[model samples]
Target: MTTTTTWALARVLRDRDASLYLAGVVVSGFGTSALWLASGVWVKDLTGSDGLAALCMLAMWAPTLAGPFLGTLTDRTRRKPLLIGTNLLLAALLLTLFTVDSPDRLWLLFAVLFVYGAAGVVHDAAESALVAGAVPAPLLGDFNGLRMTATEGMKLLAPLAGAGLYAAYGGASVALLDAVTFVVATGLYACLRVRESRPEPRAGGRRKQTAEGARFLWAHPGLRPLVLAGGTTMLFAGLSGAMVYAVIDGLGRAPAYAGVLYAVQGAGSVVIGLASGPALRRLGERRFAAYGIALTAAAAGLRAIPSDPVALVCSAAIGAGLPCVLIAALTAVQRETPDALLGRTAATANSLVFTPNVVGLAAGAALVELLDVRLVSAVIGLAWLVTAVPLFQNPASASRTATRSPSDANPA
Candidate 1:
């Protein structure tokens, strides 16, 4: 079945060289997960204060503040060098993780995390841009589905391997592995050959690329609402991560239980990510996203129901539904926007959504420290539920057919 899916996905890519890009992403994922797993452990080991450990968690979304500018850059530049360059930088940072011994240097970790997060924004923007360039827009839903499945598969496996390496070898060894993966990913990207050409102008031809990209996004009625929905959800989801340790502590579960829950969540994501193409085809992107948002709302409500086996199941459900929301939002952006603006669109979308994520993390951390874990989780969950209301009221459903060339409009 995996083989069949790979072949089908290859056909959609339409270029044999595209496989190298996917392989690069997979290798990058392994490194990313390993670094993440090792970093928190390394920090806590250095500082006995739980508060310090919590601050390190904020690194995930801090760079999101610069997303708009990053998006502008991505739109203006060719993607390949950016992809290769960022991975190289990440490899250097991972190696640096081995040298930090004092808690005071912890601020450096946040700096690294922030930079990494910023680079990640670029990666996502570039990947979307590349994919849009590589395949017809109409087939984006399916291609993205396959990509999501591969990504979730990596998410499921990387942590286990990372955790094991950390236990047996140490943070330095794990860092070494992460560095190696980045190097490998860079090599793979170098091999993939994508045609780089000037992107065509949109309806208004006079504007600069970045300005035009921004103008195009603002002009689209459907896109505005979709961004609102996606951004709001990401903010709350970022908040939820902050509450994980608190939730586990409140439930009297071991720290490892958080891992177990995440594993379950990843399992659910893999199942759905693999089917995202079919789901989009069956329901269309708007409807699929609407249902997904509703599911997320339901899941959020479930988190507030009380901590129990049922609640845990519901928590897992929240993870399961997240990928659907992601797939839908990206599909909408990919379908509605032109190739010239693909990177910027993705970056702007991320910027709009992730800014809240930074706020959400701070809010969640404050709530967990002052209120209690369960309450923080509940409040955030309810807030996420609110984001879904727009989905039900204004379903932005539009099917973008693929264009024959980059010059074509409404390319699927």
Candidate 2:
């Protein structure tokens, strides 16, 4: 690392509250990552039904569709207390899974997963709002980058631990492990010391407050393009993900090859997490996002080829490029939004950005059966390239001064 990059990372780490917040994320994230993969496997083992196992994944994701509505609770409550309570509640809920000893109890598993997902939505919204208040503005990018690194690192490591525990001691043991982490995270949240200003009083009913976030996101010139770019990238990523099986089949490789590609991709994401802060400081969010999209476009186009080495490289490139857009969009939201609306706005943005991937996943699954894999890859690639045109021409990119919001200029 360069001297400057090393110094920037150290600066973020040195902040007491930022360090505690990141620690909470790391502990909680490890368990969540493990449970995410293990839930499907546990269901499959008990029921021997692929459809039921898939439903476990769906149950967890279904709550994201209601993120905007659930996020309003964060705006109404004190954020730190909400975060602490949410984690404790999730830990208690996971304990209920200890009763699932047979296929007849699978309904309980599904119900618990659904509630887990819902709590996650609220917890994330509150955390985003809290971070904007807790961390210094100059270090927000670095904090976000380190946060990504911690989560993605868990993605690489935690599943293995969860699976090993499950295999040796069964699903109940895995739930206990996850529950323990949540308790740890709750402690970390309790340790955080920061002043959280009370949110402004709502002028209207719940219905009106819910829509306020979406409206603000659309109205902000600097945020609008970055968010759009994130959604577009996820759409193509879903389409490309559907083509993975076909690519392996064409290469005359086994299903396990997909795991190799995933590991390579994770490695690339870790590197990007370490470097994104420096890149954001130099290029600004708009240009940083556009360049990342362009790289993803190029990588997606390369997936049309059948070479294994080329495919691995393209997977790494896709991983590196995608997170750049996500971090840029998140940093923009944090910098631009007022404290009063931060919780709702961040939640709404999460819903808008991720909902399209669910759509593309379904669409791509259907289309892949009817279309050629290479042709689908090419089309997704071209679509990403087209999406970048607006970013290149965005009026905010004309001058660095234009990208700073009034809140950023005079932070309270």
Candidate 3:
């Protein structure tokens, strides 16, 4: 890492509030990661229906569609309190999973996951707004990068632990573990100390305020492309995801191969997260994101190959490339938006960027059944390559730069 990146990370660790914020992230992220895998497995084990198991993922993701509207809650309240309350609420909800012992109670599981997804949208919006206040501007990139690292790192370790627990006890055991983590995360959020003035109510009605975030993002010169790039990359990522089973089969491996691929991808993401800050400083957000997309495009093509080693390498490449786009986009939003609008802007951007992935996942899942997997991978790679063309044509050098001063960026 560059000295700037190193120092920025060190500063985040030294600051008490920032440290507490990151601690909450680590604990909650571990629980979320474990639950992500365990939910699908749990549903599958109960019903033995692939479609129903897939619906679990849809349930978790569907609430992001309302992210922009829900995010306005952060703008309406003090973020720290909102963060703590959301965590506690999620913990209480997870406890309800303990009652879901049979297939007949699966409806409860889906309902809880759907609510969990909505709470996640609110929680993420609150956290993003809070971080802009808690950490210095120069350190935002490093803080976000480290946050990504912590989450992805948990992805590497937590699934194994969740699976083991689920195997030995049951899905309810996994849910209990997740609930305990959320309780701990709630305490961590409560410990954070940051100065947040009450937000001034806007003159316009709730409708106008709800739309403000999306309007602002669309109007920004520098941020618009970065956000769009995120959406485009995710669209293709969904396409690639649909081919996971086919890719493993092509490599003459069992279904367990997918787990190995995921672990390798997580390892790659950890390295990329560490390096993203320096990369952003050197390339700026637009070009950095473009480069990451290009890498993802190449990885998509490589994944079309049937070789097992190549498949592993391609998975790692995908992991490394995807996070750069997300982190760069998020850091840019943090650096550019005013604190009062940060929550709404971040949530709106997130919804726009990620909702496509969910749509693509559904679309790709259907498309894969009809099309040849290798051909689908190749076409998806080509589409990502085409998406990068506009990004390359308009580099950050030619665009409006992000606000450099912390006070200017977050005038509260």
The lDDT for every candidate, in the order shown, is: 0.71, 0.86, 0.85
TM-score top scorer: 2
* Stretches > 4 Å off in candidate 3: 1-5, 395-412
Quote each prediction's TM-score: 0.82, 0.95, 0.93
Tell me the spans in candidate 1 whose CA falls farther than 4 Å from its real position. 1-18, 103-108, 198-212, 239-252, 368-386, 393-412
Candidate number that wins on TM-score, 2 or 3: 2
**Candidate 1 lDDT tens digits, 278-365:** 6777777666776777676677656654466855786668766777767887888888787666787788777776677677777777
| Model 1, C-alpha of 105: deviation from truth (Å) | 4.9
Off by over 4 Å in 2: 396-412
- Find the 10 residues in a row with the least total lDDT in model 2: 403-412
lDDT of 2 at 400: 53
Cα lDDT tens digits for candidate 2, 297-380: 989888889999999899899888888889998998999887877888899888878878878888888988998988888888
lDDT of 2: 0.86
Evaluated with lDDT, which candidate comes out highest? Answer: 2
